[model samples]
Target: MTEHKPEKKVCVFCGSSFGVDPNFSKSASELGVLLSNNNYGLVYGGGTTGLMGCVAKAVASNGSYVHGIIPEALVSKERKNLDEIKKMNEELKESVENHRGATPLDDSYGKTTIVPDMHTRKRMMAQEADGFVAMPGGFGTLEEVMEITTWSQLGIHAKPIVLFNIDHFYDEFIGFLGNCVAKGFISPENGTIISVATTPEEVISKLQSYKVPEGRFNLSWKNQ
Candidate 1:
């Protein structure tokens, strides 16, 4: 059996809105299940709506740890979703009780931390996670993904970063990245930092097989 790295956690960046495509949400939930089955914890933007909620619920229901980091400003907005997640977890536990042959569920409905600001939320998330995955999302998700990728470029960390391209959502971005390499904006070697995965299984596989790209640029305090 492949040894699972239970200590490693993945931070997912995605929208709070359930996008038009059903697959986006479906993929998010599937990713959650995959993470739980593989014994990997999840760290994500603390929210109960859209992809975030779907993924969080799946992980918690499947008896895995989930850490949600949210800015104080958005906690109120996510309260309803939080309540729903709690209810769903409770129901799942009740259902599990009827099946003695099944494994017992953990008391991990997941916890949410409210930070003062977005910067603090992101910093805490980055500190908590060993890797990152970008799902279909809007500007906020894109920014988070780019910032983390930039951190890798500066050698802040060499953790694997993956783009979950469900329904070809990230096709344009991937093309844009290739264009960057072709245009000499980002070198071909460095462009390999952001990996692309089409399915949840592929995402986990790529993450496990990932290696930090060698001969990449490094930043120094003196340079900054």
Candidate 2:
């Protein structure tokens, strides 16, 4: 009898806003399409705005499932586009009304499944995903990526961390990693935890090539 392997789910972290570059949005949409076509589910911040919405909508439009975890307090603050939110609300309302029985207009749009904050979101993403992919984003994206990388570094996780370095957005960050190695913050040998690629295809390929070691590393800071 042949063994069946479990399907892998990838967690993607990106900006709620499209940023200054159009390339960022293009790359995100491309990733969403690729993930859907490949039968991979998406887990991301729940926002019907900016690149987050673009990716989620693209995947959903392709009939793929997406899991969104968002913090309640930042729903308005982190929202990318107010206009898009209203549109999504209307669509969601219609879908619900068609499938389910009629509901109150106030309750038309379902409540967001919100986490406490960014920290909670990061933990959830790491716990739920087989691996992580970071798209072009701002501080929030960086924080999520760094936390995932740290988890791997501390031997808490063995998942691959891939950086979609589209449009050379992460060039300076990559250079800073080199500086970390030089300053003894991170060993050059252990730097393989992060894989950099210019496109979604390359990102998936790089992640697939990663193999967790049979024995985990001792990650005690005191010992180090």
Candidate 3:
């Protein structure tokens, strides 16, 4: 039997923590609500903490389908009870529970698949998404987005890769990509493939306007 697929699924890489800036969580929640309203299924690391938890909870609250792929090693370890934030806002308790996937908190919010490792989790998410969104995050987030971008550069897939540069969160990383081009590591033409967005609308716009590279998947430098 064929697998059932949604019209569009976006794999989002974001911080497991909310970060120091309030804008991060705000943007994440907004993006989640907006994506769901636009009928896009959300795929991400299954952590109910930080910005990851914020986005997932918002998506769930807005009545959208959200799927999570997390490594079994991190499931029990990462999805900690965020008591500090929970106490700050009484209403957030419900959101927290929803992310926890606790009984009575589950409401067609979608499924969570616990994989064997991080590699498996990422592969599953990539397989499920038509596009990728990277929010402000630390090392893990950067790693996820860059891997997808590298895959695209090599023509592994034609899916859109975007940076949700909320509050200019990704400015330095964007510059780093340019630096790679300057250093002759990445092609200038290939660098244009990355779409940077400041808002949710821009994220969709970039995805809609994404173009596939002309050449097929390959690596010239490695062979030489």
TM-scores for the candidates: 0.82, 0.76, 0.79
Worst 10-residue lDDT window, candidate 2? 91-100
Q: Model 1 clash pairs? A: none
Top candidate, metric lDDT: 1
Q: If ranked by TM-score, best first, what sequence of candidates would result?
A: 1, 3, 2
> Which of candidates 2 and 3 is the stronger one according to TM-score?
3
* Position 37, candidate 3: lDDT: 74
lDDT of 1 by residue, 1-224 (tens): 22234667999999877899999999899999999898888998866667877898788778777877665454333243445545553322211111112212223447656567899989899988989999999989999999999988888888999999999999999999999999999988899999999999999998899999975767663532
lDDT of 3 by residue, 88-207 (tens): 522112232223343222334455665678889898898889999999988899999989988887766779988999998888889998999899987778877778999988987898
lDDT of 2 by residue, 44-156 (tens): 77665567767776666666666666544454343444356455532221111111222111121112345667677667767878888998877778988898787777788
What is the lDDT of every predicted structure here?
0.78, 0.68, 0.74
Worst 10 residues of 1 by lDDT: 91-100
Cα displacement (angstroms), candidate 1, residue 205, comes to: 0.4
Off by over 4 Å in 1: 1-5, 77-109, 220-224
- Candidate 2 yields a Cα-based lDDT of 0.68
lDDT of 3 at 2: 20
